[model samples]
Target: SAMFRDYLSRFSLNPKQKFKTLSRGMKMKLGLAAALSHDAKLLLLDEPTSGLDPVMRDEILDILRDYITAENKTVFFSTHITTDLERIADYIVYIFKGRIIYSGLKDELLEKYCIIRGGEDDLLKIDRNILIGCRKHYGGFEAMIDIESIGGLPSGVVTEKVTLDDIMIFMNRKGENSCF
Candidate 1:
């Protein structure tokens, strides 16, 4: 079929290969090819890039990026690979333990929270209530805090932009009393 041919031309998998024997990547490509051949407006993929080599992962991402923008199709995929979301997701939905913790624009979420790092003396300047999570080492300390919660701390403390992974880690670190 034209769909399989198009896919094979790019991914280099044998069309005649037994489904049971095909590599996982090949099976994934075949499934994607079948999906693309249809007229569906929405595609739901679960960890499509999982277990794939970097090159194959890049190829799939390229195909998805193209399909999304060019075809105007919506892709709803769940990935523990937060970097993949950074590359393609417009919105983020963070669900943990059957609870929807966050659902909003990715940029907005990133802008609202950050990691603050400074010397041990800085701990006294920080308000404990404002910190979502904190680490107090001998020389320095790092804590996760919302931008709005940052009151009048002096100029020496530095705030670093957080990645999705950082957010997930800090979210786990947060206590039950968290305002999340």
Candidate 2:
């Protein structure tokens, strides 16, 4: 009861408000309060920041950071909002079509994948097995590749750091290698 009250106050939720009257953000806070009241070592949240304003989203992320630090707990958070993960996650699990594409430390995932852009001719020279995804356009092509899988790119190709959003898009797109 006290913990719930504390969380309610911390989130600035009105104690007298009925659940039906609560905003989406307030409902999320209420869920967090309930989960934290237990002795569980792990917390699972699904799109907790969905529909929340940026400020409220930041607040929820801050709360998560504090929870992990104070309790030495693990949070299994699932969301399409990559920005939130970029803000607070130390590890990341990326899934597409019910299959996990990547799961590891956030930094390693960021380092391991890259966006490769080149003319269609140069891109077509790459082995399809090494490509996470690829798209061919009128003038050129861009693909996602594991940095380790790259031997050496053709002269006109360039590689850039991959973001979480890029990973999602590439994984979801139709590609020559559909088995990722």
Candidate 3:
């Protein structure tokens, strides 16, 4: 707690005095680092990085990294923001509406799901089974599918790489009236 107070004091007028005044970023960093310092065997965090500025997010993630490196320690977290996962997670588990849609090594998801872009006609030519999800573009469709199944797509379309964020968007899309 003293370390936190020390860090918190940096932004305050009274350097030696303690007060309940700290910037959002500073509070987030201090809280996360302190939590890790408590020596918890398992940490369950939900969107811990949400709304933090990029630099502070990175700093907190570094602390998380150090904690996870300790013997018998584990970190389980959930976030819609994918960039953080790319930086910190060894594996990815995708969930939607409380259902576990996918769970595997991070590398495997990156290797498997890819974006295939093509006109409506060309998209019709691809194998249906290969398409996990899709988003409609202005004049074409961008599909998510297994990379090896690129051969199954029509020749006219271009297969571009995608991020976990793209896959999440497709997975989370609900048809009309699904929302209340």
Query: Which lDDT value does model 2 have at 167?
Result: 84
Model 2 root mean square deviation, Cα atoms: 3.0
Clashes of 1: 0
Please write out the lDDT profile of model 3 over residues 55-162, one tens digit for every residue. Answer: 878877877776688555889998877998988898898888889877999878887768777887886677666676766767778777777777755789887777
Candidate 1: where is the Cα deviation over 4 Å? 176-180
Where's the lowest-lDDT run of ten residues in candidate 1? 171-180
C-alpha lDDT (0 to 100) for residue 109 of candidate 3: 85
1-180: candidate 1 lDDT, tens digit per residue: 776578676767777888999877778888888887784799999999999988788878888988899989998999998988888888899987789989999999899898988887777766778887776676877778898877687577898998898888878777642322
RMSD of each: 2.8, 3.0, 4.6
Candidates' C-alpha lDDT: 0.82, 0.84, 0.72
Q: List the residue pairs that clash in candidate 1.
A: none
Question: Please, what is the TM-score per model?
Answer: 0.89, 0.83, 0.77
Q: Pick the candidate with the highest TM-score.
A: 1
How good is model 1 by TM-score? 0.89
Q: Please tell me which model should have the higher lDDT, number 2 or number 3.
A: 2
Off by over 4 Å in 2: 177-180
Clash pairs, candidate 3, are none
